[model samples]
Target: MLHGQSNAWAIDYDNVYNDNNLPEDAHWVRTIGAMHVYNRPAMYPEAENTNWYVASGKAPDIRGGIQLVGNGMVGVLGLNIGLNLVASQNVPIAIINGAGGGGAIASYQKNDSGLNAAYGRLQHRLEASGLKLHIKAFIWNQGEGNAGDAVSDYKNALYQLYKNLSSDYTFEKFYLVQTPPGCSASSGHQTVREAQRQFAAEHLAVKIITRHGFPENPLFDGNYFLSDACHYHAHGYEMLAEWISNMAKYDFYNGTVDYQAPQLVRVIRESGKSLSIEFDKPIAVQPDLKVDGIVYSVKDQLFAINSKKIISISELKVDSKNNKILRITFKGKRLTKGAVITYVLGDTYPDTKEPYRGPWLVDADTGVGAVGFIKTID
Candidate 1:
């Protein structure tokens, strides 16, 4: 995972990972904060299966499924976990923190010239990498600068920024995180929140995650803040990180539909070795074979898999003792050498209003990751 840390956000990645007892796969790197303008410190990390690219003050070059963390407002650890999820899922993510505190949009900067410049530089570097990099999301968490100026064209700029960024990037998935609840001076904490909410409503791809209900421990308790009444203390940072983690984990898109099934399913086994698979009227997507959870996807939705290792179930014969079990005979070849043939079955939901059904099938050594079949036909 990668993150950015500056005056507003202090992230010690090693500390967070170590404290959490995370596995070694959770490798991460950090970017220096607001004053850092060069790319030297950011791009030097050794690339691994998952890479987190974070920016505190400016945007950095990122490709593949790498996540870019910016916006000085996101505390070090909060950004860390978000990066971790993106890395694990191998998806691209980008975070843009408006200049912090009293800044336009209620961040630190009265102007966003730094952010604008950073955006331009990041775009150029990404293009230079020869990778088809696309920006999919944006996270905003600033509003201190425009406290009273909420009445100004602040709303227009916010929307304009999204429009302009999206013009270059294709993905509409955007998230607006409200500024922390407490600001010492006159800040547009509430007004900006309203404006952000309004922006999200008007835009189909945009949504808002509220910080209005966040605890005000740092603002009220001097102990929770550093000498400066603006920044948070260690404990406060942890709380903020936890809040961001929750936001990252929230799934606005859960399109679970009622599954309907047909009758007369056929089973095709295509593995060189035979695998033992049982059929259930209402079978779990991926049954537990060993320990680790395996994720399978027919389309884009996440489904369970038995495991990564392929188990051998040889000389399998289909016997239809009951009229309900319909089995098909097929020639067996080799499955993937390392991978086993997991069960492929029709999905049946017991609670559906309509008759639920599907056919389960499997294929082996026909080809690499052979497509086996158990299709349901009415």
Candidate 2:
């Protein structure tokens, strides 16, 4: 099952977008949806003939909700997952979307908001398919709604939500996609992100896949979308599904896949205007990394510091002697006392065009992208 907000349902969820990147056998694997965004197999007529018709469910009330008509539609995430599992594990599967957009973590809980009537919707879908007791896992992409909430509160609420969800369906594992950046409601984008990290760490069954590695396309065919910073395009959603399915394949069926990415674990202040970021593994710089809000300063704010600021990057590269520690040297002033750093640092990305913003690193050998982090220096 797929869960969470717009990022999960997909902002650019046009049938063309979904069909453009689907695997060959997607339609053969049956699928369905909760209420908000259900699946149809029009793309693969074979699947419709062999499986489900579009469910007669009510459309959700989201800012950009796709108006449904008699025409059929395909789920960008589900069919991709189905095809991947079939190709690799040789097992057929059906995916369900239980997610609704514009909802915070609290809203999706047992009895919080009407949107979570999705829980009831989910129950109905499963019963209709005769799989109320045969669910395997839940793949999710959320947290933007809870970005403004207190970190600790978000943590407990998300945990409770998980426990509550487990009560309704007997699913075994949970797959969480790390929420992408850009929440204008508050600057707490990183706060929600950190809380998600902690939640995944605390739960053994929950596996986290990073969305920051792919490209973020705010515009579809030259149209600018508000979802630019946070939501990804069809390609982005496709990669996310691929990651989730890959990890699920490895986790559930003992298939071997390299879905793990390099993670930032430590940060060190090297003497004089330099900082060293340590990753879990040796890092490889695939492209230039641009970060936001950098300044050189002294131990105290009272002291006069270098006036030059890092609006753009000076240089972000791996140190010659150390593959694990990426050394960054700022222009002009030395970084000292009271200084901090952040990632993808501006309102707009004027640099690279890769999906998601820069500051993206990866495992040197596997090329698996590194996880984008919170305000933490690493």
Compared with the true structure, what per-residue lDDT tens digits does model 2 show for residues 49-77?
22364321122324443442111223556
Give stretches of model 1 more than 4 Å off. 1-23, 28-78, 83-102, 105-116, 128-133, 215-225, 234-378
Q: Return the lDDT, model 1, position 345.
A: 18
TM per prediction: 0.43, 0.72
lDDT accuracy of residue 208 in candidate 2: 68
Let me know the TM-score candidate 2 reaches against the reference structure. Answer: 0.72
Weakest lDDT window of 10 consecutive positions for candidate 1: 362-371
Best by TM-score: 2
